[model samples]
Target: MRLVLVRHGQTDANVRRELDSVPPGAPLNELGLAQADAAGERLATHPVTSVHASRATRAQQTAAPIAAAHGLDVTVHDGVHEVFVGDLEGRSDREAREHFDTVYAAWWTGDLDAHLPGGESAHDLRARYLPVVERITDGVHGDVVLVSHGAAIRLAAAALLGDTAETLYVPNTGLVVLVADPAAPSGWALDHWDSAVPVPGDVTAGGTPR
Candidate 1:
């Protein structure tokens, strides 16, 4: 089985570098749509059998073009949602670093026990994400695409690659490819990973380039 994990495109939260974990979702901005389209074009050559997305609006929107081209519906999976930020949600990176020192430290150190202020821990994230991956691997026999959040994708990749959590970094709309073979002793191997925007020209929102 081959798994292609993609981080959703930029949103206002992304541009502002705010932590977005709240409900009622934020849809993708223009650059986001273009990134999603670029991602779809890149995957057009691959034999993707299914597309899965988080319930988040940005994720759903990012999955749409790919699904349309592939004639597959986006499978919404709540388990793939971004890490809940609690009081830190909507806060800027600077603000988070200033006020949530322990949380930031934990994150920097890749501490599994570090929890966001009133939110879930990295360990909690692994618990939630890994099971879904297991299910996908068990059910899908072909290439699968998953559009999700940055932190979640990083955690998933770290877990799958047996690397330190702090070692994983995925840029906006990044793609990380993993090949899982039950026949292999390791079970899974990293095939390729990149955050290169596949779009040819500079994408714009309204009249301004991002």
Candidate 2:
């Protein structure tokens, strides 16, 4: 099965460079709504059979349009939620940068046990996130969309595809596509990562690193 992991559209916290990783996360801003529409438009052409999203408001909102286009109701999964920021939730970028850098660097360096204060380690995240992907994709056919947060998507992509895969920052509304790999030990292969899709000007372009 092909799994398309999409980062939710821009949120107020994203524009303000603040962390918002908890239940019922912030809703989409205006540009974010437009981005969601554009994503829906693009995905409407794909052979997506199932639409999944995190319980977070932004993720659910992002999935709505796509589900509408496909006549499919979104399946909410807690495993796709953002990395738990814990004490850092809603904190300013300046205050959170050090913590973000430390933990994320460890994620890139293969230390899945590292995490922020009162937050989830990379290992903790993959434990929940990968299983959701595995369960959803198991015995499934055609394509599927999984709308989720930035950190969760990136970390899960790296974990599933292997350490050599790029762990780049996923722009708002970014797309990552993966497919089952029977030959690989990880059971997955990256078809694309942070793929750029045309959206409003505020949304940036990204994809697999060249």
Candidate 3:
């Protein structure tokens, strides 16, 4: 089975660059709703068999259209939630973001223990996220779609794909396609990656917490 890992739609926190990675967090903005629809439409031709989403409200909202299009209901998983921001929750400023970046970059340097003051370490997230993905993909025979946060998706992908995912960026509604691979370490290999890196002069551009 192939896994289509998607980042949830945009939120006001995403626009303001706030570190909002908590459960039942901000809902999608207007543009985000449209983006969600587009994502569903984008997969209309694919034979999607199952759909799953994180516990976050935005993730559920983002999963709705995709599930509806496939005549399936979204299964919510508690373990697939975003990396807990703990002490960094609700802060939106240059310092907080830079601090987040600094700590997250350490994870790329083989420091899975590095983390924000009270947030989850890279090791912590891999433990929580990947097993859930493996479980869902294992039982499904076709495509399994998962809607989750940017940071969580990238971190998990890094663990599965090794260095190829270290610098990967998955923006709102972006898709990371993974095909089952018995030869791969994590039993998955990258197929296609959809990156939403904003173009120059694009004001609609806002950073996601990838």
Name the candidate that leads on TM-score.
3
lDDT by candidate, in order shown: 0.72, 0.79, 0.81
Cα lDDT of model 2 by residue, 1-210, tens digit: 899999888877666666778879788999899999999998998999999999899999999999999999999997878888777888755657567766777767778888778988888888899889888888999998999987788888888887667666677778889898899888788887764443433222221110
User: TM-score for model 2?
Assistant: 0.90
Residues 110-190, model 3: lDDT tens digits:
888997778888899999998898789876788899999877887888787865553466778989988888898767789
Worst 10 residues of 1 by lDDT: 201-210
Angstrom error of the Cα, residue 133, model 2: value is 1.0
Candidate 1 lDDT for residue 71: 89
Residue 177 displacement in candidate 2 (angstroms):
0.3
**Per-residue lDDT of 36 in model 3:** 94
Candidate number with greatest lDDT? 3
Clashing residue pairs for model 1: none
How do all models score by TM-score? 0.84, 0.90, 0.92
Candidate 1: tens digits of C-alpha lDDT, residues 1-210: 799998887777666555677554678889889988988888888888999988898998888888878889999886888877777777765657455446544655668788877887878877888888888767677789898876677667777766632334566677888898665445777877764332322211110111
